[model samples]
Target: MTFQGSLPADRAQSYEEQRASPRFALLLRAAKLVGAEGEYLCIVRDVSETGVRLRLFHSLAAERRLALESAAGERLGIEKVWENGGEAGFRFDVSIDVQRFIAEAGPYPKRPIRVGVEDVARITVSGETTVARLRDLSRQGAGIDIDRHLAIGQHLRIEADALPEFEATVCWRRHPSYGLVFRQLMSLEELAVRAFRMQPGRLR
Candidate 1:
C-alpha cells in the first residue's frame, strides 16, 4: 500500500545498528493467542533479532502474549508491540544477535557490484522544501543530495522507492548536495532490494 500522507518527523524510532544481512526462516502458525478475552488462533510470520511482524486471524489486544516458535521447533516468547488494523508487530522476549550470525555465515561474500541509485527523493521540513537523491548506499548509510544552506542539525524526512518513510538529520553538506545517515537504517528486506539488483538470483 502506498502512503501519501503527512507524518510526524519523529513518528518512528531511528535505526541505530548497522543493517543485518542474515536470512533466517520464519513460520506462520495457526494457534490460539491468549489475552484478557481468552484465546484466538493467530498466524506467526517468521522471526528476527529485533521483533516479529505477523498476520493474525483476529485482532489482538495491546500487550498480549502471542506464542512464537523458532524454525527449530522451540517455542519463543513474544509480546505484542504494534497492531495495524489486523497485522501485528511483536518484540521477542529474547533478542538474537544477528550481527554475530551474519559474521559466522563464512567470510562475507564479495558483493558483485555496487547498486546505483539515481532516483530523486523529495524532502520536506517545517514546511520548507528540498530535494535529494540516492547517490550511494551501504547497509550502514546512504549518500544523498541536498543544499548546503540547510542547517547541519536540522532533521529531514525522505520519500523514495523501496524505502520505508524515515527521518534523517543533515550530517554532511557540500554545496548543491549533502549526505544524511538513515536516522532509521533500512531493514533486511529493504537492503535486499539493492543487494539483489547488484547480484541477480542471489535471493531465494
Candidate 2:
C-alpha cells in the first residue's frame, strides 16, 4: 500500500528540480486514476514526458498499477512512484508529449478565457441522466448549474448541441453551480467558434 520510489528528506521541495524533462504547471487540468476500487478524480498539478504529480481529494488504497486519463484525451499507464499526504507521483509506461499537451490545454494564461452561456445540456452520471444549464464554457471545462448535487470526484458524460458529447469530472461544486474539467480539452479556436455561433450578440 506504499509507494516504492525513494523519498527525499524534505518532500515539500519541488521534485521537478531533479527530473530530466521540465514540467509545466497545468491550469484547470484534471486527471482520473482508474484503480482497483474505482476511479478517483485528481488535479494534475504538473506534468512531464515521464510522469505527473496528482493531488487527490481522498486517500488512495495501495494499488500496483493504474491508468491516468488527461483532460486532453491522453491516457497513460502509471505506477505509483512516490506519495506524501494527498499528493502522489507516478511514472508512466511511455513518455508523453508534454509540450503538445500544454498547447492543447490553451495558452499559459493566468486564467482561462470563459464565455457566458445559457444553453441547456444533458449530463449522465452513474447511470442517471439529468438536465443542467451551461453557465459558462471554456477550453478546459464548463460551469454547470444543476439541481442535483454531485460528488467532487464523480465522472459524468455531457451532451449539448453546441458541444460534442465528452467525458468530464466534477472538480468543484458550490450549491447549484459545479465546475467540471473535461476529459478532452477543446482548442481555443474551437471554443471561440462555438461561442460566436451560440451567442452572436454576447461574446465575452
Candidate 3:
C-alpha cells in the first residue's frame, strides 16, 4: 500500500528494572535498533545507565546482540531484555552517561536517521526506464547507484518492490552512487515497515 497518511501508535510500557539511578524521558526521539535481520526504527521512551525503553515501529527480530544508533551515528551495544505490545526494553553493555544519551553526544553532528538496504530498483526518466541499486534511505532522501549519467536536479520516478513509486530528483552523484531527494516524503512508520519488507528471510 502506498502510504500518504500517518499511523498512530499506542503506548505499551511494563518494563521493570531493579537498579535505578536516574531515568531520562525523551520526547519522540528517533533512533535505530539494528540487528542481523535489518535496521528497525525505534523511539527512545526513557533511559537510564543500565537500561532503556524503546517504542518499536515494526515487529522485532530476534538476535543474539543488537545495537542502538542515534541520528548522529553513535552506536552502543545492547542486549534485549523483553518485548511486548509495541514496546521493548534493553540493557546496555556498559553504563552510559545519561546526559550524553539524552543530548545525543557523538562525533558527528545530529542528522536524520537513514536505514541501509540492498536491492535493485527501476527508474523512469523522460519515458526512459533504467535499473538502479538502492543503498540507503531516509524520509527525505536516498542513496542510489545508477550506471547511466544523470545531471543534478533532474527529475525521475523510482519504483521498487518493497516501496511505493517515488518521484525523486537527483541531488548529487559520485561515481557509482547518486543522491536523490523524494518529492513526496514518506512517513517514518511506512519507511520502517517497507524497510522490514525489503530484507530477505527476516523471521519475526
Candidate 4:
C-alpha cells in the first residue's frame, strides 16, 4: 500500500495539539531511524518535547514503532505519525527534555555517528595488501578486521568496491580488528547513503 501524500486533517489536528510543549528546531541534524527491517538515514528538521519532524531519503517501513539514534549514539523511542513526500513526523514515546536532547547531554561525551557494516575491503600497507572486512564506518574513520597485525601509526590505503579509496592511519588494534582514522572526512549525506548501501538487505 502507498502512503498518502498528506496526513488526514483530523490526524493533522491531533499532531498540532500534541506539540503543545515548547518546540526546538534542530535544522538538518543527521540521524538514523531504526525499524524492524533495518535502519535508514534521516534528518531531524525540528523537535519538541512530544513530537519531531524528520526528513527522509527513502520510504520507511509501515511499522509504527521505531527508534531514532543520534550522531552521538543516543537512541530515543518514536512512534510514526505521518509520512509524505520524503518526510515524516513522529512523536516520542514519552515527553523528552528538549534542552538535554538538543545539547546531547548523555552518559558519554558526544561522538561522530558510526554505522555497522560487513563488506569486504582491501587494506594496503608497506607494499603489501590483504583482504579485510569493514566492521563499521563513520565520517572520519572506519573499523576493519584483518588477519594480520600491523604497527600503530602506519599510514595505509583502504580500497573497497563500494567506497572510494581512503588514506588512513592505524589508530587502534585488537588482534584481527583495527581502527583507522581517515585523512578526509565524508559529508553527512555521503556517509548516510554509503552506510545504507553497506548494510545487509538494504532497502531497495
Highest lDDT: give the candidate number.
4
Per-residue alpha-carbon lDDT of model 2 for 1-204, expressed as tens digits? Answer: 155565675542334433666778885565556655444556678888887888765556566488875555455798777777878888777787787666554333335556566678899998899999987777789999999989898999998888889899999999699999998998755775564444423333
Q: Model 4, stretches more than 4 Å misplaced?
A: 1-16, 61-64
Clashing pairs in 1: 15-184, 26-46, 27-46, 28-44
The deviation in Å at residue 150 for candidate 1 is: 1.7
**Over the stretch 68-186, how does candidate 4's per-residue lDDT look in tens digits?**
88866778999898788878889888888888778876666678777777688999988899999998888899999999787799899997877899999999998788999999999
Give the total clashing residue pairs for model 2. Answer: 0
Candidate maximizing TM-score: 3
**Candidate 3: lDDT over CA atoms?**
0.80
Worst 10 residues of 4 by lDDT: 1-10
lDDT of 2 at 68: 78
Measured over all alpha carbons after superposition, the RMSD of each candidate to the real structure, in angstroms, is 18.1, 15.2, 7.7, 3.1
Clashing pairs in 3: none
lDDT, candidate 1, 89-172, per-residue tens: 666566766544223232334331123355566777886766666665544455676663677777877666545566877777
- Give the alpha carbon lDDT tens digit for every residue of 63-87 in model 3: 6378999998899998776677778
Return the TM-score for candidate 4, rounded to 2 decimals. 0.85
Q: What C-alpha lDDT do the candidate models reach, one value each?
A: 0.51, 0.72, 0.80, 0.82
Q: After the best TM-score superposition of candidate 2, give how far the Cα of residue 11 lies from its true spot, in angstroms.
A: 61
For candidate 2, which ten residues in a row score worst on lDDT?
195-204
